[model samples]
Target: MSYGDHGRPVFSSDPFGTVPPGGGFFTPGPPPGYPPQPPPQSGSVNLFATLSVIFAFICAPAGAVLGHLALSRIKRTGERGRTRALVGITVSYLIIVLAVVALLVWLLRPTHTSASVGSSGRSPTSSSTPVDAALLDGTELTRVLNQPFETNAGSSQRGGVYGLREFGTSDERTEKCVGVLHPAASVTYRDSSMRTFAYQQWSRPTGDYAGAVISVDEAVVAFANPEDAQKLLARATEEWKQCNSQRVLASWGTDGKFDSWTIRDVDTTDSIVTATVGYTDAGSGTIRMPTSRALALKGNNVVDVGVVMFRDPTKSADPETSGIDVARAILDKIA
Candidate 1:
């Protein structure tokens, strides 16, 4: 279209019926306030999101991992399938909770039956004589130590097993708890009085000598086998003779005064090495206190039976016999 007064023609500015501010146009370009269109992206589906939903049912952990990756890709490269990733994550969490609950139920399940109790309130599994490691318990220990404690020279009531969780009860707790095989290292522990024979020992042994006190009065150390036991027994017996006539300075308390202790020969058997250590006061030149120490090597085991006698030093009674009795009791139980 055109309009004129002096042959000046005005051309139509509209593309169709509307004209943009730029005016002169026949074909329409992009609309106002709208950016130019970008090239079309591939219409292919996101493989990660597809795999995430599929794996969520088969393997929850794999599904959760894939879902996380899918979400990251959607943010960076503008992929689709946000819904699929979310569904996988939700299902994975539910599966995890269900698995944990199943484990708890399996672990805390109750026993359906009870064992028979005898007249002594002991189980039918109890053994009366020659108790093995499987039969070592409070009742068995009580039977072993029930006799008089000869170390005192006067009859003292032999108490129940030492250091058992409950002192006076009867159970097969040790039979199940303690390992039958020997421990690999020295096993020294402090008593309620905060005292130990760790300092009194001449040399540290290859095996532990203290943990057995949990089941018996004697401190027993286990050897690898009977041959090792015999070798230790022979060496210890030889040392007893040399150590008997010598005076060694031994200090254990916080007083910082070491006593000139003399080891007196008591007795030595084919299986035992026993002696008494007498402490002499430097100021008075008299015997103050004496402590008896005993060691017996049985098959695959070494027993330590010690007695501390501070009230008397000149008592005619043989303190060695007490130690012997203790050693014998230990062997009887473990035999």
Candidate 2:
């Protein structure tokens, strides 16, 4: 009767303790039992699904390992995402292996070609002929001046031809020097004094003059003033005379004019010597003049010598301009 005060079932008629048919704890039909099937085993989150997510983000070994673990769990537990995990692991492993092999190949290749060898086994130069020393000697020079003249073989223009008398060559040597000797030509003109004058002009420098000495093969010639030019020309002439006194490779005033001369025994094969001459027109008078001479020398496989002269028409007698005059004088002496 007094259920609240004594230990007794709330409902006397009911055998087991239960909420009254419509009590707050009571719900529809037997607390919604799991459809009369074995009580649903606690469902697990798919490990393979988790692995697939991790593999997609991390990639490579870490992703690969996690994917493998997930696959095993999927096989054991029959997980729903086994296929996804397997794909991720396979892709990540393939990418890593390919990258490593590419890196190794790039690190090892050679960079330049070795020089070619000849059949003889010796250095190519050893088999080449030696340069002749006499080719460099004055004996091979062209007889453009009062001395024997030799052009620079190395400096001469390519495909140039020369006569034996113009240059000398030995079994070991070859003289390939050449030059042109243009004689003076007379030009008739009137001077400021209204007097008819005849001017003679040589096309090239005739003597040792001051200017640059370019390489034939690689010879160099230094020029000086009248005093020095005269001396050098004299020495050159003497050298020529020694070779042949009767023939006198160089001589003065032999070409039918007081200032005219001839160069003998010139080696047309050698490079010619070239020089520039500078001169001023004096008193506005027509005068006979020689052109600047250019000479080139080649020997010992070296061609290096050239001369240029600049003539100042404004300054007739200045020593500064006299350098060209001096050069012309030297040319005259040698001629």
Candidate 3:
């Protein structure tokens, strides 16, 4: 140690052992009582921070633990991964909260099937009740038709259930009247105990676009009991009363032309409803075409018959078809 011109004490040399012309105290390292620190480390991403983000998708709980540890270490050690640690911690905690919420929702959700059971601990039976196959699909059902259908000239379709609106007029009032002419026109058929249905049609093959001169449609609808059949017939009779003198327009086949019908007369009895409908075939020119339909209920079955008889417009009188004969023949077989 030495004294400068100012009378201040100065070290002869720096701790590094080098001195200038003007003596001054110099420190190449920390002052006394201070421990040496490690070199200022370059900013590096924390291993836990990286793992936290990676495990957030694969294992969220593990990621949250790693993120918390990384952030604690970053704060205490003054490392360079503060941003990485914060991002990991934030993302990891957010995923954990979302997972917990989802689990709670699933655990608390309502069960629909359990609520539908009655106090008897039994589920309610389905509305659709299957019936005997022999009613609508048996050979006896087809044999009831009195019309002489040419060999292999008859085509039939049978099903366990049928919709009334699948065919016929769209207008409700007109459809009510049309239901007598066409069994498939009554939309309420499915509401009853209608178990099985069959539709049979026989047409004389004309082998041309002129269409079949005489075609017959017979539909057989079988129910579970005679009372159900009676109810449907009564309901149909009420609708038929409102359908008098209504014109119905409908399409025929794939042809672009349309056919029309005029309900001339509607008659209803205790168990039968009959109607005379005037049909005009768009392809057959402006001519008077007449059709008759009869619907009757007997026992547990209802039979509907439609007969179209096209006569020469030039002739004053022509042979007419009877729908009553066809309907009675089929209804007789129902019992």
Q: Which candidate is the best by TM-score?
A: 3
- Misplaced by over 4 Å in model 3 are 1-148, 151-154, 163-165, 168-173, 186-188, 205-213, 252-258, 281-287, 313-321
Best by lDDT: 3
Identify the runs in model 1 with alpha carbons over 4 angstroms from their true place.
1-217, 253-256, 311-317
TM-score of structure candidate 1:
0.36
Q: Candidate 1: lDDT over CA atoms?
A: 0.48
Instruction: Compose the digit string of candidate 3's lDDT tens values, residues 1-335.
Output: 66768999766545565686564665477788997685465577678878877887778788788888887776656566657766776787888899899988876643225553433455333223222222232233234433234322435666666533354455655545545445444464857788777666665445532432366677777777655666787787676667667677654345554457666567754345777776655676333556667777655677777766666544211212366656766655543
Local error of candidate 1 at residue 106 (angstroms): 47
lDDT of each: 0.48, 0.32, 0.60
Location of the lowest summed lDDT over 10 successive residues in candidate 2: 183-192
Ranking by TM-score: 3, 1, 2
Candidate 3, pairs of clashing residues: none
lDDT of 2 at 254: 38
- lDDT by residue (6-109, candidate 2, tens digit) is 67735543345555656445434544655543333335656655665566556677777877788777666665666678777877788778778876665442
In candidate 3, residue 290 scores what lDDT?
Answer: 64
lDDT of 1 by residue, 96-128 (tens): 789899988866643211222222343223122
